[model samples]
Target: MKLDLIEPNAHYDMAHGKPAVLEYDNDGSWLYRLNIEPEMGIPEGQQEETQIGWKCYEVRGYNKATKENVKKVVIRSVIDETAEFDLVNSYNKHVLGIAVNESAVEEYKEYLQFTEDLDAVLIEDLSN
Candidate 1:
């Protein structure tokens, strides 16, 4: 399938953890993976922050009018809107992680800021 990014080069962080590590490749591109846990999925209560994910996706359908595959990338703060902000939730999806187009790095970073804002708003509620 053909793919394109609305926001390509943004950097993001997990509120409970450190920022996502961006690895640069010789080809001048970057990538990051969303890991669930070291072992069993449970809170370790460690000082180190885990970088949860805010995945971007593309939805596709057959366009009868154009006889082409209609595609759309879904950019969201998290996979689920009503679902609580949890690492597990982010982990299940985006397992393959995200690869950014060098040109879109700035937009990619800005797009990822949603996590920072979301975590700030839910901090108190999450503490309970």
Candidate 2:
């Protein structure tokens, strides 16, 4: 999956340079984080690392269970052509219940909004 690092909400501002945030509702859900790095490789006869060709996008999420942080999803690539389609399909499949007219708390509404916004951006990026 090609994952893009995005500031989905004002809370992201508090993350400083690190793109990290508790999944919008802040109900001790998953903490989403992004890491961008140059794909590096050592050239023959060279002792230094060099950028191979592409920038790697790593999307990671962690959940706090008890007192330990449990790793959740860790997507390694976010630039694949099919990423957007796959994401939308998966989201629809998994969150269809919530996406419908379901009663939810205010915090859950905020979380839905965040997901919607993120989806919009991903769709936009795909179109471009």
Over the stretch 8-90, how does candidate 1's per-residue lDDT look in tens digits? 34433344443232333555443332222222222467665444433332122222211111101122322444333343334
lDDT of each structure? 0.33, 0.39
lDDT of 2 by residue, 1-128 (tens): 12344322222221243333323335545544333334468867999987543332334343442111322133222223365454455456546663543323343444446456555544443233
RMSD of 1: 19.9
Clashes of each: 11, 3
Could you tell me every candidate's TM-score relative to the true structure?
0.21, 0.25
Residue 66, candidate 1: alpha-carbon lDDT: 18
lDDT of 2 at 3: 30
- Clashing residue pairs, backbone N/CA/C < 3 A, model 2: 2-78, 2-79, 3-78
